[model samples]
Target: MTETLDTTVAFRATMGRLASGVSVITTRTGSTPIGMTASAVSALSLDPLQLIVCVGNHLFTRTAIAEHGRFAVNILGEDGEDLARTFAAPVPDRFAGVAVDDSHGVPVLQDAIATVVCQVSQALPGGDHTIFVGDARHFTHKSASRPLVYFAGEFGVMS
Candidate 1:
């Protein structure tokens, strides 16, 4: 037990040093939208245009993505720290007062630096998280924006 706890703590500390862009993964169940802040998102393939996002097992957004079969990754800019914290919090109705575009059937943040709509292609087990592999379907980006980054448990912009 001690070894497991030590490893977990060490793992988190080591991973924290590696900066990552922040994003909001969104999906819908009926007309209600669900979303969560995420940093464990990455491109998995280019040939098939795939992306991978790890969702915690305890999050309801994980189940929503599984059932909905689609999701949008809203890449946050430096101006999006508040949006990140809002979705990360336990607040009910994270979308309240937030502008969104649901044209692709998945809620996309209008203020995001970039947005990628994807169709879920595979779901794999990843320790305490579910690894969702998605096929890119639609995408939009703003070239001039700076990405919101997360490192050492704090949010910032790239130097």
Candidate 2:
């Protein structure tokens, strides 16, 4: 009999080696702000200014995105590990005590390396996650700082 490999473990380990930029994907339901740490973001296109973020079905942000139809992608800087952890945690207010500013009426991390405000162009099912494709409406970036990176299931800076 052949021993079966644990595909889940193997897949995670393999994907963990793929370094990705860390970001906070935020969306709102009315006055309530919801966000989470995510590294599954991609620039899908430039001509149409398209971007994509994968959100797990279990996250509240997933429902917010579907209801509000808009989101902000805040690209974390090297010093944003604390913020990343805060967002990733099951906190009551992820934005509590966190400075934020509005972009196209959506809340974005204050002084983030980059922020993109987008409208939900489409949402597709990606296995257990939902792929939210956004049409970039507005964006801003400042400061020449290194980005926060996720690799090997840990946060690191590209140095």
Give all TM-scores, in the order shown. 0.96, 0.94
Q: Give the least accurate 10-residue stretch of model 2, judged by summed lDDT.
A: 1-10
Give per-residue lDDT, candidate 2, residue 113.
Answer: 93
Best by lDDT: 1
RMSD of each: 1.3, 2.7
Q: lDDT tens digits, residues 55-144, model 2? A: 999878898998999999999999999999999998898898999886466789985799999999999998779999999998888768
Worst 10 residues of 1 by lDDT: 1-10
For residues 65-147, write the lDDT of model 1, one tens digit per residue.
Answer: 99999999999999999999999999989999999998999999999999999999999999889999999999999989999
Residue 76 in candidate 2, Cα distance off native in Å = 0.2
